[model samples]
Target: MLKVYNTLSKKLEEFKPLEDNLVKIYVCGPTVYDYTHIGHARTYISFDVIVRYLKYKGYNVKYVVNITDIDDKIIRRARELGISPQELARKFEKEFFEDMEALGLLKADYYPRVTDHIEDIIKVVEKLIEKGYAYVVNGNVYYDVTKFPDYGKLSGQTLDQIKAGARIEPDLNKKHPADFALWKKAKEGEPYWNSPWGPGRPGWHIECTVMSMKYLGEQIDIHGGGTDLIFPHHENEIAQSEAYSGKKPFVKYWLHTGYLMIKGEKMSKSLGNIIPVKDFLSKYEPDVLRLLVLSAHYRSPINFTWEKAEQAKSSLERIKRTIERLRRIMTYEKLHIENLSLDEKEVYERVCELRRKFEEAMDEDFNTPKALAEIFEFISYINRKINENKVPGPLARYVHDVLMELLNVFGLLQKFEITGVSAEVKPFIELLVKIRDKARKRKDWETADYIRDELRKLGVILEDTPKGTIWRLSK
Candidate 1:
């Protein structure tokens, strides 16, 4: 059975979906004010691995990530850009999907937008008001924290504590300092929808509660997001949901991934170090980014750096070379008739052990870095055996199959294509090397160094091996 570290219970608990063999999950999506950054990528990719593993283990998983198309941020940004709210949301939604697809994140089963479900949001708000859990003040409706005794259970913050930490512009109509808005009265020159209390828009928290309930029912199997969302966002979700449905638990499992930091600091716009996913991917391959993210445990913070990405790229290239060499050896007719050697048998056993270790690590709250290390260990063994020329045809094929299976589980190795040097570029490189060799023979050190420097700028790396000069693309 798979185990998950639930933030609510503060322990690793065995995963038990409300319905057997079927898992229903709801993930909070982007607010669509700007382009998604690397932090967003980390959270979504972590959840993608979880979903992929669940299907690999024979569970039918239904994943839903809501699109928050309406909010104060959206309105503020729209006003700044001098566009309609719908236009602003549409532009960013397209950009968000493009970035997600580029990173190989699977499309969620349902991507409900708040604008499309305004009727349902209104209905839920109306129910809360009728049940004495919500009150309207001066055309704005707010959820009364004083009415719900269980308000602090999810966030572990009492009303008194929230009051102490609260520092927003005071409004006279509010009953308490900690209460949050259910509906905000639309200001002049803003998008407004007709409601019982006048023209207004749904609050940020109510959109998710309504959309999740509309698609996945009142109670879900798992509710997941970043750890930063565990505050009033998720806490309010639980309150409004349970208050409306009279359900004991709104969610069975609460999973939160840790933050992504850069150089020992949180990545944020205020710090001026926020890197967009598109800009980052333009400089590095997607698989390299994936490996870098998975190198750290999902629950731990990932520190971002270009050097870390380079290491991941090198590791991935080594695995690619091993697979290619194994395929080439298996195609050799002379190797087909030979019996497997003792070393080949040892490699096969090591492969099995590595697979077991990978599963064990993942079964323990999705420890991806440990599982990734196990894969690297297996790759090292295969590389050593190939260098010694001790691998047989059948054994080589087995290793290739296992490598592909494990890599696919992490969405790596899906685009394993042998990159050949282009005919034109190959000839140019050969010509330059020949000239460089002539220059070296004549002891023209300046000319030789210039040639090497130019090629390096063109993404070509040259190495001096005993066999002669070897060149490859700079990963």
Candidate 2:
């Protein structure tokens, strides 16, 4: 049975979806006010791997990631750029998708934006008002924290503790300091929609509660975001969602990814060290980033550095070479009944052993760092077989297929054209790419261009980034 760490319960629990063989997941998405940094990439990539593994285990998954297209950040940035909030949001939203694709992330089933669901949001606020869970002041609506007796269940704090530690904010005419907004009355020069309260927009926490209900239903199997969101964001979400629906548990599992630290400090705008996703891609392969993230447990904070990225790049190259070596060994027909002799029995058993280890690691709270070590162990076994010349055609083919399936579960090796390649051509392609790199480094423009044009004629595409030149078979 698979098990996962539940942030809400603060324990490792066997994963049993609300409905048999189906999982409903909701993750908080970007605000879309600026470019996505690597810190954001870590959260998305962590959840992407979890979703992929759930599907691999024969569960039908419906994942929803919300896009906060309307917010104070969006409004402020839009005004600074002399553009409307809608235009600014749409621009960054497009960029967010592009970065996700470049990182090889599987797209969520629904990317519902807050701007498109205005009617649904207003209706929820109206329902909360009618239910006595919310009150209005000066056309602004706020949820009555006192009404929800279990207000701080998710964050594990009492109302008194929250009120004492909460940030100082402008007096919003709320009943208590812990009370949060559900609807905000419109201010001058900001966008507004018609509502029963007045012309205004949905509050930050209300949009998620509204969208998740409309798309994924009242309660979900999993709800995830960064660890920083646990306090006010997720705590408030749980309180308001359950209160509105009269549901005992708003989410069965509350998951949070740990922070991505830079130089041992948390990434922030004031730090001036936020590295954009696009900038990281320009320096290393997408798989390098994925492997680096998976090298640590999802709930553990990861320190980002250029040296670590270089190590990942080198590690990925070694894996690619191992794959090529397997393919090269398969070119000559060698597997026969006699070839699967007594000596090969242990080899076959080792394959089965590694599969079990991989699954066991993943089952234990999606333990990717342990899972990766299992993969590396299998690779080492294959390398030993290669040196011993005991790898037959049947064994080679089986190993190739299994490795591909395993790598893809982690969203690695998918971007590489690993299948349907002959042993003779791949080596020459690598050689030519290396030659072109040397030529460019020495400012040999003619040689580099000639090689690129020649490769293009043969359906090989070459892209030159600051790191180096990379080639792929043209689609």
Candidate 3:
């Protein structure tokens, strides 16, 4: 059985979806005020792997991530950029999708934007008001935290404790400091929508609550985001959602990805340490970033550093190299498999065993680091088989296919190149390389160098190896 660590319950629980074999998930998405950073990549990639594994296990999932296209951040950024908030949001929203695609993240089934769901937000605020869970002050609506008795259940804090540590804002109209805004009244030159309270926009936390409910229903299977959202944000979500619907558990499972620290420090705009996702992609492969995100367990804080990325890159290369070796051995109809040698039988069994171990690790709270360790062990076994010249003939293909499936679950081995070349041109390049190889064998240095230099100019990089020459499009 697949198990997940529930942030709400604070324990590992068997993953039983509300409907049989169907999971409904809602993850809080980007604000779209700026380009997504590596911090955002870590969170989205972590969840992408989770969703991939769920599908691999034969579960139908409906994933929704809300796009906060209208917010304080967008407003501020628009003012600085000398554009309207909507214009700024549209620009960054497009950029966010590009970065997400570049990072090889699964597209969410629905990316519901706050701007498009104005009616839904207003309806929820109206319901909360009618249910006595919210109040309006000076055209602004705020959720009455005192009315929601179990306000801190998700975050594991009592109202007194929350009020003690909560940031103080000089809002004399608020009955309690723990109370949070559900709708902010419009100010001069700010965007507004018609509401019962007045012309205003929905609050940040309210947008998620409204969007998740409209898209996935009141009780979802999983609600996920960064750990930093566990407090005020998610806590407020649970409180307001349950209060609105009178549901005991708004979400069946609450999953939060741990924070990504940069060079042992938290990445922040003020710190100027934020690494944009596009910038990182320019320097490293998407799989390298995925591996780095997976090296640490999902719930454990991950320290983002060049060292960690290098280790992940090395691990990823090891898998790719092992697969390449397997590909070479699987072909050529190797003569060793006629009688099923002792080592060959052992290799087949070991590969099968590794698959089981990998599944088990994934079952245990999506333990990717341990799952990857199993993959590394299997790679080691394959290398040993290659060294001993005992590659399984047809079984080698099965081994390769299985490893690729597992690696794909982690979003690795995606072919990303700087430029796109047509399929018709590929064979001609390969033919040229082959003819050049023959020339080299005949000691035709000038001809071989000419071919090499010409291919390099065309942006194809070639490396001559003992097994053969391998080529790829240069980045």
Question: Each prediction's TM-score against the native?
Answer: 0.87, 0.88, 0.88
Worst ten in a row by lDDT for model 1: 331-340
Residue ranges of candidate 1 with Cα displaced over 4 Å: 167-169, 331-341, 421-475
What is the per-residue lDDT of model 3 for residues 61-163, given as tens digits with 9 covering 90 to 100?
A: 9999889999888998899999999999999999999999988888899999999999988989999999999999999999999998888889899888877
The TM-score measured for candidate 2 stands at 0.88
* Model 3 regions more than 4 Å off: 331-339, 416-475
Q: List the residue pairs that clash in candidate 3.
A: none
In model 2, where is the ten-residue run with the lowest total lDDT? 466-475
Better of 1 and 3 by lDDT: 3
Task: Please give the CA lDDT of all the candidate structures.
Answer: 0.85, 0.88, 0.87
Q: What is the Cα-based lDDT of residue 209 in candidate 2?
A: 91
Best by lDDT: 2
For model 2, the superposed segments whose C-alpha errors exceed 4 Å read 168-172, 331-339, 418-475
lDDT of 1: 0.85
Cα lDDT, model 2, residue 370 = 98
Query: Residue 347 of model 3: what lDDT?
Result: 78
RMSD of each: 4.8, 7.2, 4.3
